[model samples]
Target: METKKYPIIVEQFHFDMVDPKTDTNQNVQVAMRQVEPSDPARKDELKSGNMFEIMVPFDVIPPQAGFRVSGKITRVVQTLDYFGQANEISPDDLEKLSRPLIEYIETLTYQVTAVALDKGYQLEFEASGNQKDNQ
Candidate 1:
């Protein structure tokens, strides 16, 4: 049997900061959820296996730093061939698909901190095998 294949493309992306700057030493938390598109056309596209959406919400707290960041990143990914349900995608695959958005988060945080503080702070995220499903 031939393996089904799907090419994923990001259709839309948006990022927003909740608390742009903060002075607190707290741990970082990251979570991801599959969101339903608000647009009827987008919903149809998703139902037809043409696309799906994933939102990653994160919070970063620096230790004794002048600046902290908390934001959410949402990306709409298009699947070119595979016409399967969103829940059918594996966790590993989901992590791989969300990698770019995660990197964006890191990049933006670094850039923002560079100006907010005297130096830039680097952040690294690892797949903790924890996936949250929000309906």
Candidate 2:
């Protein structure tokens, strides 16, 4: 059988919350955007309509959230494809893509923790929240 493999990119990864432990009392959203592909030698690479969004309930946030937020986007490529068509993704493909997305989520979690820790010693602050933007 003939075969063609296209790239699959994660356009957007949205999460309702990052902290499952405390999400019951709050709301959260995480969004990721994918840009059009580029070629080093080409001055003008296509740049439009290559974005998507995903949303999940706050409760779904993992107990340990970090650079690798479970269910967050993996990677954004050209078209979501594996050994066959885009519609039929293999388990291996899924696993391969998941690693990076998970890493990104884990990283975000650490950033939030660091900020929270930094302010813990302050005496005048009654309450403080940390907003993290991770890679």
Candidate 3:
């Protein structure tokens, strides 16, 4: 029997989601946003209750059963500008820019997928951590 788990794949990119009127990125338009550390460690700009909200795009469920759903970062590039001139990026800066994304990916351990089945789906999930603490 095929079982379903939380199939929601949430992939996030750090970007400033604001009205173009306020702050525009006309010069360097990127698919992903720049992740910055907040003053208070717990207060992440991507988290709720912040000036800029991180927009996550994912389907409610997968298209077919037994199909693999992936959340991967295809490309991460950084560019630095100096004296009205821009360069590709240095290895050090590239690593720095990709640090947060790398950390986020490390936390994934098949915990975020939620299967949508008629019943008995709960029993198939691996319950170890505070999975019951929040929900």
lDDT value, residue 44 of candidate 1: 64
Q: Which ten residues in a row have the lowest lDDT in candidate 2?
A: 119-128
TM-scores of the candidates are 0.60, 0.35, 0.25
Which has the better lDDT: candidate 1, or candidate 2?
A: 1
lDDT of each: 0.55, 0.33, 0.27
All models, RMSD in angstroms: 8.1, 12.2, 17.9
Best candidate (score: TM-score): 1
Name the lDDT value of residue 82 in candidate 2: 22
Residue 37 error for model 1, in Å?
Answer: 7.4
Candidates in descending TM-score order = 1, 2, 3
Clashing pairs for model 1 are none
Per-residue lDDT tens digits of candidate 1, residues 12-39?
3332333535544333333334445677
